[model samples]
Target: MTSEEFGAAPTRGRRLRTVVVFHLADVTGPAKSLRPRLEAIARRGGGLDVLAPAEGSLAGAYGDLGTVCALPYASLTVPRTPREAARAVRSFARDVGLFRRELHRRRPNVVVVVTTALPAALIAARLEHLPTVVYVGETFPSRATDGTVRWLGGRVIARLCEALADRLVCCSETVARQFVRLGSTVTIYPGISRIYAEGDRAGFRARYGLEAASPVIAVVGNLTAGRGQDTAVRALALIRERLPGAQLVIAGLPHPRPIDEAFAASVHDLASELGVERSVVFTGFVERVADVYAAADVVVNPARFDEPFGRVALEALTAGRPVVASAVGAIPEVLRDGRDVLLVPRDDPVALAEAVSRLVEDPALRDRLVAEGSRRVESEFGEEAGIEAFEGVIADVLEQRSNGPRSRSSSPG
Candidate 1:
């Protein structure tokens, strides 16, 4: 059948098979972000396949996936050096060849490119004449951390990726704003898995060697300078004065950059310097994140940078824990100050401590925040809205493609 003949849209009951591609094996980035949606598509009796750097390397992170039909090839996440970037560009042709073979095999209804693997995936989509949707999770004008080299070709590469895609799905309004002038863009806030609500508090505390009655505060995300775990550790010094039994839990490993063991150690040194060494618990890379949230008296997202969207905060709120978050980027949009969460300026340990202390000391305030936070998560940050919105976008893009690709500028997003 001609592409125009297949322009008809699928009804509510029809199935839509999809193939999602990623660049890196990062445990919590685009690959992990889209896994739940892929499962949803499968439950509807629709087929799902994932193409990425390597399959078994990171598949274990998603322990819940009984079977993962992931495709692995030569790919890198955000190239740290110009040589690496140039090499990745050189490898694009090979990636396209591999992608073409996959297209012939699956004959997917649509191709979805998760964060990081942009131009390469886009090239593959166009080569196969398949509709493409790229989800933007990280910032653009992308730069490598700890390196001064400018990815001089980044802008040109980004423009090409934008022009080729049928649609761009951004993780937050802030991310959407960064790319609106490029081409079609839409804000689709990422969703957190509901499994967090099931973690047992007692088991989590026991695993971390935390006392059952201790007031534990959780600061999740990679242990990096930008993530601001130092701020949380420093706050522990101040928190211990008011609530002597208060403890701090740092629940993740280093980021994708050069493993910053020095920085991670520096955070611990700061904790010890503040005389709170005994109170700080570093639970490096726990698989059961829900457990960490459930065991916490309060949760904090103290990232110093403008976080694209703080999914950790959503997970905490979903688990019914009061949140103390940085009021920057799209976070203020996800959570409200005073009502749903206590929002403080980024990098301010004093304010972070005070906010966390308020939740720790005031039982009524904690209860109110927990109630409002869960309500907000259920209304917006839960899996249903995001999954439905993403699925609809993919379906619409495919329909437009099948319709013979008019400049459908009216609904550019």
Candidate 2:
């Protein structure tokens, strides 16, 4: 897609109306990143309507930008039992009918499915012959432990997406590479704002009982297994051996899944085992995440998995705090090793400790990383950049649909 295509004025006929279908109604990473894009649609005199599973924080936030509709949908999950598989088929068919009815009633010009998890929405849009855009944000895991059943399920989902959707907007090139067989794929980096850069440093430190002069290390994602909060805790113990006044602040809540909850408990247990529990603070969920960056001197992202995009690392750089992250996935795509962020090996506590300690002790290195990181975020990952890229994709899809029908082999049905 060219700049002229994306920057062109809206077609001078009927008004453009878009309906976005999402898998979850919670305040998740995808929902947060998509807010600016939705706003851009409204700014271009396009009507917006959102469909979600239920009512939650995301629904409320999107209500201001568009008409929020509560439509239930289920994700395609690998079921173990025979009964579970039967029920999954039933639920999927029911939800597809629901979505098809809703789309027919709304009569949108184009349909946007926020995540690849919602295959039903793509199928429904195809049945209606409406142009569709699906956002591919996650990479399917092909590890041995994932089990053959789950791996096959992932392949099925990818094939369904490739067949049904008109275009796939991937979050990063790493994610796009996974869908090489797909006909149309675009990599649009999610944007971040400078909201995190403005906060009360002294007030946040006082509220969290952190010493004014102590070195504070923060990890800002949800408490999940691959998030590597346990690694951060261990790194804190190693850092405190030299700078005894160091503190580690963990600032997000876990998902309701049993595995995630267990991982959260294990992180606390590991901190206690290292005898550094006293130096660690667990603030479950902060309403204003800017406060966490304000109280921290350095941020760490020791993710063990192939993170599709490092939003926390971007936010830290935008907040003007130096970052030490694992050199995995698309992280190295946006952040450099010495210039923008200090890249360390994944799941290695000793290496993570050394990087965090080096940044804390060397003020010149921290300043240089922060300066370079801020410049990169402004130039490439600003809010306007994402909006323009997404708008371009939408325009291209609409134009193609107007010209003729897209060629595809099969549908989910």
Candidate 3:
């Protein structure tokens, strides 16, 4: 069989049956964004089944998709001893079995795996003769902390999976390069989702008891160290000196680790010390993120490190709000500094404050950004764009499979 002969079948308009595996127990940004796209795909007459870690948020989120399969998957945290490693290994084995069972039943055309548990999915896809589509939502290995032994083992496994994958979908260009650097074929698919736009301005302001006319600066995401909430708090101190009536509205859950505890405490203490504590409000983890975005005048995503991409920036754009984000990663790709978003250096409270000031003082610039960014997001980075990108990858993979004798990679084969 030759490539040309295999691709002769018209797949340009064909809908494929897909089973997406997300064996992560927690609800991270990536999972939240991917869910709507899968839902949309399922609605379009594509068979969709989700297999997740057999507990917590994953189980609940799975209900939104097709049939849900839950299995054991341990986190890097919790029980760092040798016993924990044994538990993780056991969990991986169980997930492999679950994958096999699902593959047997559905016999899907493609299996979309979304996590680093690639060994099991790759094997199952091979055994079932199913093309595998792997979505790399973030940097592999670096995002989490594991021992040197485990990290090295994971890297080897990831490289093997890369070669075996029929198509790779990454959340950002930075993440896609990690695979591409190793000469693995991949495509850049931005992490995107539709914002929950419901609450009116009055309703949102009342929900948080915020003033109608006060300059409201909103921060959304896990209140982790690298997320740069502390930078926002410090910036608030600077904003107070100029605008005195400025308020900071924080809507996010705290990190699981106590590392953020000290930082959270300091944010409050600094607010009090600067006599601006009354201006600082913390609404810990609101279900409707759009409500917060709607209520705020401006949104800030001042992550200290290079974020793969800032979902909040898109959400703010969706909500018709101006954003001040760090000039890092794929964020710069989405934003045009001073036009769509005000780009600032990461972790610099002074710079964050300056950008915030420009937006607050200049109403024309803020409104211009809000209008332009909203259009950009709706057209380029919303659920619509995400689904199209996903569908494109599926088409390419199936076309490749149909047109030729399969090339096997010994790495994962």
Model 2 TM-score on a 0 to 1 scale: 0.91
**How close is each model in CA RMSD to the real structure?**
5.1, 4.4, 5.1
Candidate 3 lDDT: 0.73
Give the clash total for candidate 1.
0
Q: lDDT of each structure?
A: 0.76, 0.84, 0.73
Off by over 4 Å in 1: 1-9, 29-33, 55-86, 141-158, 181-183, 192-194, 260-262, 405-413
Top model number, lDDT: 2
Runs of candidate 3 with Cα error greater than 4 angstroms are 1-16, 54-62, 75-91, 117-119, 140-158, 181-188, 191-199, 255-276, 382-385, 402-413
What are the clashing pairs of model 2?
Answer: none
Worst 10 residues of 2 by lDDT: 1-10
Question: What lDDT tens digits, residue by residue, belong to model 1 across residues 219-239?
Answer: 988898878999999888888
Candidate 3 residue-wise lDDT, 1-413, digit = tens = 23343244536456556787775665777777677667766776657777765565666775766777666543333235789778767766775665676676666666888865556777667766667877776554443444576556656656777777876677777767666435354554554455445546778788777988899999998777768887899999999899888999888766555777777777778778877788889988677777888888889998875676678898788878899998877788767887789999987899999999989999999899988887787777756667776667777788777765544322221
Off by over 4 Å in 2: 1-14, 405-413
